[model samples]
Target: MSTTRTRARIATILAGLLVAALFAAPTAAPAAADPTTRHRPSPPHVVGTATVPVYSYADAIRESVWVETPADSDGDGVRDRVAVDVVRPREAAAAGVRVPVIMDASPYYLCCGRGNESELKTYDAAGVIAKAPLFYDNYFVPRGYAFVAVDLAGTARSTGCEDVGGPAEVGSATAVVDWLNGRARAYTADGRRVSAAWSTGRVGMIGKSWDGSVANGVAATGVPGLATIVPISAISSWYDYMRYNGVRRAADYPGYLHSYVNGRGEQACADVLARLRADSAEETGDRNGFWAQRDYRPLAGRVRASVFVAHGVNDLNVTTNQFARWWQELAEQGVPRKLWLYQAGHEDPFDVRRGAWVDTLHRWFDYWLQGLRNGVMDEPRVDLETALGTWTTQRDWPAPGTRDVRVALGAGDGVTGTLGGRGAQPGRERAYVDESLSEDALVAEPGTGGSGRLVFLSGALTAPLRISGSPSVRLRIRVDRPTTELTARLVDYGTAERIRYDSSEGVRTLATESCWGASTAADDACYRDTEEITAVTDHAVLTRGWLDAAHHRSLRFTTPLRPDVWYTVTVPLNAYDAVVPAGHVLGLVLGQSDPDFTEIDDRDATVRVDLGRSELVLPVTGRAGLPSVAVAPSVVTAPAERSSARTAPDNRQVP
Candidate 1:
């Protein structure tokens, strides 16, 4: 036997034996004297903390249905119908046993696909689903769970206009939960009405990226029958996806993404697409009704389902701020939640920690969906990656002893400044011309005055410095132009090997495959293994923030700056966690028009900063001032930085 097949067989046997040894209870009673017992099918097997595989995966029933929704985004005068595919154990119907659901709703099923292999859904000759993408169906169907795949409205086989993350898109997915609970109607491919007779109506939604975002929106609605949600690298707000603060990072993003996901029925959706472009208002980049409809944070108080969130600290596509704000809101509402923080970028936990991830997820589903008395909730609430391949368990995020440390930016050579100093020179000021340049060119020299960025350096740390939350920057400044994009970066200067997040999302697929459950010819349960990618670098950008000067006061309103007049603006950087080495130097860079993250504009603008009034507030462990020191004036050299793409972080083509 080949090594791959042998490993696959071993893994399957181990997972089965794990639960069987723990409980070892008969699932069904022996056939009785009653004649009716002979015709009844066996029930699902149950163990101590999970359901063991007792049904045949190949014989599971596979079919498709169209669910009626209230949204008529396409303006066809008829209500929109969402496409839903289902795979469940045959025993669910024959033995009169109703099973729970595991659902993944996404627009990527047709255009971009799902998982590391990018597998698309395939159909059989009967026009029914043959091969469903990913291993969800193959693994969970035999364990007494129904797996559901939904083609979001306006994408794939569903009908309607893709409104990005607005009401239309959210309505399409939530309608499925309503259908399972007997609150909505559904029909077969032949237009015959159908009902979820074999379902328990307990749903758990899980996915990555946009698929995960849909789960967030649906959970915010507090729909009945939604047991829990597992959102990996998901976005909490649509405004944060297209821009940061008031700076527009991508122009006409809604229209561009809509075109990417919906390649068919263009004419029918022309009006909807046009409205998406106008409502986004790329020119102003201010928050309005369109954005409010898509924001999920305000509705956190209404969420009834437990949440399990997983995010990559270095993920620049959806970014860390999304999960940060979502986690905070869930906590404030006193909701049950769990979190997993990794060191990669834009990837799933199944790809990073395959074995542990599967085990934990299995227990979580058993507890929430099956009502098992498992100890999954008795463990720690947070799992954070401290370094490459190393993890630690914590009671909560932001480490318990973290405090905000205020560091002064002192004028040092009229160009570069000193951080963590005793006091600042109030009368001293630094000036820089706003121009388009790579981050490497802007942060090149620490002691020189020839660059277009104002740099500040702290002395070499004698002890390790660990930051665990979002960092904020307060700048008192005046600009030569009425409006310009303002940017700030927190950097680490040292020579070390770190996860290569910018390269293939820090993972490489291998030839060897690992199987999770039973399989068949059309849909299998095995997938290619993956390994983390690392690189040796001199420096790394810890976090960055951007803002439009005109909208500094509020994300909803804009007031152009008065040339030569000082304005105090606060820029909040992305949330992150890192431990700087004892000998590494912490640096801060302030500039305009970051070519790597923001749109380039107003090249002739110039910015001036009052060194005394500006400060950086960081959430650090131990004494706030213990990890910072003033750098010697003679040490002028700094390390070069790396840049990432300024477009969407997916593999699909964009306009």
Candidate 2:
């Protein structure tokens, strides 16, 4: 839980020398004045936006230096070294105006590149960067910020073996931040010292996915001089990213990904890659020390910077739980924060909601870096996107003052059972085989119990209801086997067609273009037009949760079940903000396996549910924020149960 646990200083420290482009010779322009001074820009917030066009887009300096780390992740015995690419306002450096830095540290730069364009960095003859990936430099350097693109240890131009998401990867990135603050060192190719004279020593890390995950890792160190971070769709725990409970989302998923993004020939880092597979403990899929070392949630209280968190509800890749758990820790620590909960999947906010995202980022950086009174911190803390692309600003996430509404499961006259029933169903239990099935099949005709799942529905909604946060599935059940993994999904089923968000991965790029900032031949700030990915379907998955029966006691510890023993377990679903319209049936699908997520577990165990003690607890803001749908009737009644058996406390928050 402490930074010192894996901290090891690199011995071959190199002082940061002159950064080429940012340290360019003096220019002859009024806006680009003070070239002789070489550090500060003429005016701060000159353009006053993320796209402020002041610096030369074509002239932003692009250079690279190596940063050494103590971990020999490459297994070569020699400590690993990281490659850092810098792009900054040449005028700011020339003017002697030390600027705060915005950095994107990533391992994907070598393989998948970055952003929607899939851009990989282009290098010059001397191994310096000729062109960097993405639009951060194109857009922000002009606005007076230095942008650093770092190649994590063992990836891209860096020297080392890959350790996947282990300490080597985390420590290597942290070393770069240390170098920026003069707490560590960096060196040029010719062995020249490179001092960060062009920097204020204040840094803000930003990125999506793996890139963003690094940002979280660095901040967790409780390091000084890291001013802020904007982690978009990032991983808080590598364990959560690849596994749920004791069952894996995919066996050795990180090992496979580590090899893929390493860029080095497989043979060069073969031992490192092999070790990842062995250390991953894929067979048991249990949480181990390796997972704990990569976990950043426990270090939340140590973070010194403000956080701007963003995540999409439909991001099956990272899932909402990863973000929610970290965010919860940050809240408990009382760290300055802001959030944007979108409706897309595995996406970047800049790509989904470009303009607003940029403006907010602009203000955020200004307030933090330049010490401006932009009122960004004073604004509503949460901005939520709806299923239809509409948005709302909430005072706090989960819509402040909300409570849980428990809906019990009961068998109805039809195939699917009843939800929000007053008592247990006519049957003592409902059962399904542990056959793998797509979510589509499980919810397609919920009324007709699918082969792999049992669906329970509430009466036709009399009024619209929306869930602002995560939902939990509390079930009291007995299993015939010693262990089994269970999956539960919250869905909406009806005749009306809705956007098939999951089909297209939540976004569809259009033929047109949407420009964010200025552009250059090497990197353009414009991207393809993207509209909300939509579809007509009878079902829409609101959220889902999973648990290993063995993990029913604790994710950190395994407890094999005793057959025929009834146990009450609580499973927290991913967080979401969606409005379920009136007349659309709300259903809960309980199944043993999901083909898209879990691998097949051959041990089939019959599960017996005590319906009277099981229910789905939903977080809702009492009849508010449910616009565009008809109101519910006062006296609601379903075909199955007459009185509601919602046995849990009402109007009380769940955990």
Candidate 3:
């Protein structure tokens, strides 16, 4: 090699070494606190810029208490009590150094379990907490932070009926916050009243799924002392959880879920279960007083604590709409917020990106709960996983330059249709039958005549087209029956390996283990390793929407359609973020009663579509990159003619 090349290479190596050495060096201790600012001085037990293990984890104090709530869910003329298990640093309490809290209130503490390993909380012989399930206690406790675990009311040892996400369930968390702030009552196991004198009255609630949901609910109540919350793949509305656009997705789920999570077999909760079933209104799948009471979006203005939200883009169980809708409201309310959107489905960030997740969380808590002068809030507002192991940061979600673009549908030779800059010619029509078919059948043979579905295809793109938000489909159609289930899917047709987010939440656990922080014999911070699951497919459904035709105009009531009368209806698809490759075609498949997602009975009605009045509206990013006529060439062709060089073992994404 030339001397110049060798010298340049040596300089690069030296620069990398210098960077590594700077990071390996220890940070200087924080300076004296300023009383006028929010920054607080580090206590004797805490000794780090952000936070580190300076205290003993094994010697942390372990205790349990019962917090009284104002809800009489069991209706025995008494208020309900929520069970709380707490672990904190012994040195902080001994030295009278009150510290903030990191709490996880969950119903799964005793039943169904938590996290990827499904670990449950354990107790010692003296009835004190022996082991808390996650790494929060073992790691944060040694960093001078207390980790409190609470079994939500109606589950485990708590005395109340499980009301799903109703007032009783929400009260379970708010009451605990109230007690920590010295505004409510709490008692020890021996019946002696106690106060949270050792606490600074600042709390940060963090959890996944149902546990995270409770955090959202409590934060919405505008409770004081709640410094911040980290809700991972959580639900914001119970109505959206069980239904979508007036279509029941999980029918009779409230009562079934209550029974599944309640481990105590208390007969008093029987009436609560009956009430849940009765108020669900499964017959009409309409939003009623029951769902209104459980929704947190309307109360977004009341939130006082900052929020750090994380959710999966492909989550089908709690679904992405839950977070999208809630995030929009939080933005409108001008709440201090941050977001992390992953490519996986219904999974926690701990399993997806453990090391980074832990480090980021530590800084977030230090800034919000400990009042540290950490620059975590000044960082980017959104962290999105674009693909497996590939991430990008943005100032906000839905990308910076996202806008809705209307792509019209054109007529195909009665079998297939075209999607382009303009709608089909006047009087053109396409028809289908209600057969409750799988997506595979609905999207198959798009170039030829098919049964049970109508297919529209955009020409293979010349440039990568990125969609950043929800898409909606508008159609003018007539059904032979009063009402029928309508399913619309936005699909990407090309051969590319993608994360199988729908399959097992996009992760598979390995036998190897990794440790996060200090550990003891009773409680360890080690967890099994996990890897993302991916597959090569010819076509993948980007997002889908389902609607009950009769309730399209109003989710609260139904309007029966007259036979052969054309009525325009809109189907709002789920939120999604993805980029389709240049050679890939964007397809729209319209059918009735999707067997994979909806469980409604099939009406077996014939339906006809007016092609000239149908269109697809997509939230496209970088409008200049995709011009008005750039979506696809103004050409009508079968999907088969577009490409035959690609193949996949599974053929397609199920939904």
How close is every model to the real structure, measured as TM-score? 0.90, 0.86, 0.90
Model 3 ranges with Cα > 4 A deviation: 1-41, 45-48, 624-655
- Candidate 1 TM-score over all chains jointly: 0.90
Runs off by more than 4 Å, candidate 1? 1-43, 624-655
lDDT of 3 by residue, 276-353 (tens): 999988889888899899899999988877889998888877788888888998888877789998888989999999
Candidate 2, residues 1-655, lDDT tens digits: the string is 4555434222112112222322221110111222333344336435432335677767777778888776777667777778898988877777776778898989878777788777888877878776777767777787888889989888888888667667777788888888887877788988787867788777889989888888888888876667789999989998887878777776567777776677678888888777778877787777888788889999987887788999988888788888888988988888788999887888888777888898888888876665455577789999998656688898788788778877766655535666774647434676666665555666665555445667777667778787877898998878878778788898876544444456555777788997766776657777887767776665677898888888887777778888757888877788887878887777778887655566666466777777777888888878532122122112212222121221212111100
Q: Per-residue error at 413 for model 3, in Å?
A: 3.4
Which of 1 and 2 is the better model by TM-score?
1
Candidate 1, residue 27: the lDDT equals 20
Alpha carbon lDDT of residue 263, candidate 3?
55
Give model 3's TM-score versus the native structure. 0.90
Ranking by TM-score: 1, 3, 2
